[model samples]
Target: MKIDLSEVGRPQSPGARAVNAMTCDVEDYFQVSAFAPYIARDSWPTRECRVEANIERILALFARHDVKATFFTLGWIAERYPQVVRAIVAGGHELASHGYGHLRASDQDRAAFDQDIRSSKALLEDIGGVPVIGYRAPSFSIGRGNLWALEALREAGYRYSSSIYPVAHDHYGMPDAPRFPFYPNGPDGLLEVPITTVRMGGRNLPAGGGGYFRLLPYALSRWMLQRVNQQDGRSGLFYFHPWEIDPGQPRPEGLDAKSRFRHYVNIGRMERRLEQLARDFAWDRMDRVFLPQT
Candidate 1:
């Protein structure tokens, strides 16, 4: 089923000062980086494409709450559906880069990564008619080992990146990374807004939104983000994908139990939870919340 968030008035700024940087990674379900092992690139075309339907649902949800967010878009998606990119910008949201082809920065070498960043930024800017200053790597792939990606992003004219996850995970994360925004490449380095994580019991906990937000109860996710804010005094940078709100989207066959569970868990509950979240806190575009004003 398709839901449309268009025609609704853009949400006004929340009553409180900005509390968190809410972001959405603009990629379809079939484009998830982890699924690359099971789903072939060629096969993506053969699968059902429901990104527009899902994007509408997300946009509608944000419209109801009057939340303006940053959408980290994929170059391929923009190339295919420029209107979707235009729609997002038209709705008072920011357009950022989610990299072309949705490939992780750590997976590609310097040359390939350079090309991907530049091309994606150029495509998004041309289509959205806005400066794409923020980038989030696929799967939070730019960790300590792939620090070079930061330089590439800086060279590409991006001002900040919500790419590093400071939690321990098999696919991607830098457990020792800072939980808040910082200059990773020294003072001249690109601004790094590592996904929000709380240091608990001597370990970095995954508090940034994703599967963790879906798999765990909404109350817990809310509490963690709150703690990151009220106690830690930093904006909790949260992110999710268009697919997270679409439960009826086609599920590819043969994915293992773990992958299946991660992708499919609690989708039905997401929309309602997002509504509560919108009412529960103040949210703004990543750039406004993280980037320094002149």
Candidate 2:
């Protein structure tokens, strides 16, 4: 999600202050299953204990800061860790879908993608005890080539999606879409809450937290959130994953040197940065913050 807290409701609301939403991308150790070729999906079930331990740390930190968040969880993880999903719900966090197995929505064709969304949503709602209204594609996988994914997301009953990143990147970013959240006309009139970025000098600055947030210094990340909300008159969506906070997660072998670096770098500082963000801003779950007027 974007983090431009200070610039939100600027010229638009004039003096209104916008609310920032915090979200977590929940996946099991094996669901990153991207490195599946190297580590095999079957082996993941055994590795989840470590993932669960890390998530507990995150939950404790959020409690300390009194931040309510949304967890877009994979159905597979929900099925495996029902207690984790229950805990998230009991803590009053919104439960949203992060697909079934962390597959890229863009990578799956229409029929498969459609099933993935339906299955994941049903699974998360059943386990988390909340009507799931939000979705975030695994790895920000929606782009021009897969614009059709929005129609499917709408058809599957999602109201808002935090999957677009309007920045140029090798894996996932839609560079020209609106920088802030807007309804991208789709079957369900999907609201695209893009990962935050600032259009500067014709280039987009990475303002959304995740790998970018951890890679950049905390001062810069926090300042960018304030700058976007204060200057742009829109709320910033800030998201990170439970795994991101776990620096000691087992590293998968066989990823290219660069892939390994991007996935694992800065895990050590992620939890601290998250705490700082919670204390600095008013963060709520997406279901609570993204309500549109009828």
Candidate 3:
């Protein structure tokens, strides 16, 4: 599992360009971690489910741009809407795991976390009919306290994970973690790919996608990603959820100001910005871009 970073920034073939990893966290809007306090997990099935239609739109968008991306999907979603998993695979996209029920890795003990990852991986593989080798923790929950989650993923046959975010955030982050992909356990351990960040003013600023991509101006966000590619000479990992492009997703009533804003800010313009992002650079699946030799 020791990734050869020396060849990462280089083009796949002569005259081609280095491609960044484009990923989507496949979960419904109600399943977001911030909403756990407001929306009870029991009510999830009763809530309006818009993920299927939203994913269809996303698939069409990627098709229009000729981009192949990864979908870190939930077992819950796959179970109810198996066709969604089939559609993702049908579109020639990588179908990875987002764990079942959207539980944060930090909140789960080793036994529970192991069950979640293993179950989700098996469910995705059974439905997608493709090997599910990648896993992204809900809300990027693998941090200093729960680094063992990465090992569990490896043991469960996951080759790599993009669950660590190196930036400082109130909800979840291990600010001191390496900004790029590295072996958390050792050279032979699972490859942990942290979300992209750019060094500025002696700190790691969030350059990868999420709510930040929506909150910030698209030009600024694009600049940070470009810096990671051109300045740092590496492939950047960018991610967003299917709900991000759905501006009309149901808004719960009891959410606080911060949670409401973070979830809904600039959502109306997300698809347009994504289209621009697709046009701006080369994008590919996580396995293809990071695990080329696999």
Candidate 4:
């Protein structure tokens, strides 16, 4: 399972373009980690479900650009909205798992973590009718504290994971982790692809999508990705949530000012920026970009 890092997503021939990984963490606004404190998990079943509509818009956006991306869908959503899972697979996109309940891997012990990954993988594969080999931890939760979770994923039959954010964030990050595709255990172990980051001023700055993609000026975000593509000459992995593009999503009250700002800032501008991003660069699914031989 040892892959030559240099050969990953490299241009096939001279003058060919490097294809970055386009990914979406499929979850609803009510399921966001920050909202977990303010909004009880039990109430999730009753909340207005907008993820189906949002995913429809996302699928349309990808279709317009001819971008075949990855959808790390939640088992909860798939169980409720099987059509969404079928739609993603029908659109020629990769169907991956984002765990069963959006539980942080770090928050779960080894047994619970194993069940989460296994159940989610089985559910997604059953619904999508595609072999699910990829899993992304909720909120990028598989860091140093729970590197064991990566092993759990591998044992659950996942071939790769994009679970570690290599940036210093208040919530979840392994700032010292590699910024590109790497095997956390060994060459034969599961491939852990960290989120894209730009090395600047002696530290890694967030280049991959999330709140940063929405909060930062679109130009600057593009520049960071361009730098990773041009300077480092490596394919970047960018991710966003469906809720990020849905500005009109139900906003829960009693959230802290910081939480509100992070979740809502510039959401209105996201769809436009994403359209421009898809046009500016070549994009593909994580499995195709990193595990091409599979």
| Alpha carbon lDDT of each predicted model | 0.84, 0.79, 0.90, 0.90
Q: How well is each residue in 31-147 modelled by candidate 2, as lDDT tens digits?
A: 663465677666666664565676688788889988888988888888888889888888888889899988898779999999999999999888877899889999899888888
TM-score against truth, every candidate: 0.93, 0.90, 0.95, 0.95
Per-residue alpha-carbon lDDT of candidate 3 for residues 119-211, written as tens digits (9 for 90 to 100): 999999998999999999999998878777887889999999999888899999988888888777766767888899999998999999999
Pairing residues by index, what is the TM-score of model 2?
0.90
Minimum summed lDDT over a 10-residue window in model 2 is located at 1-10
Candidate 4, pairs of clashing residues:
none
Of the pair 1 and 3, which is ahead by TM-score? 3
Pick out the ten consecutive residues of candidate 4 with the lowest summed lDDT: 1-10
- Best-to-worst ranking by lDDT: 3, 4, 1, 2
Off by over 4 Å in 1: 1-18
Per-candidate total of colliding backbone pairs: 2, 20, 0, 0
Clashing pairs in 1: 5-60, 11-66
Estimate the Cα RMSD of every predicted model relative to the unseen true structure.
7.8, 4.1, 2.7, 2.6
User: Candidate 2, residue 202: CA error in Å?
Assistant: 1.0
Candidate 4 is scored at a TM of 0.95
What is candidate 4's lDDT per residue for 1-294, written digit by digit as tens?
223332133434445577899999999999999999999999999999999999999999999999999999999999999999999999999999999999998899999998889989999999899999999999999877777787778888999999988888999998887778877666777888889999999899999999999989999999999888877888889999999888888888899999999999999999999999999999999998898473
Model 1's TM-score against the true structure: 0.93
For candidate 3, the per-residue lDDT at 122 reads 93
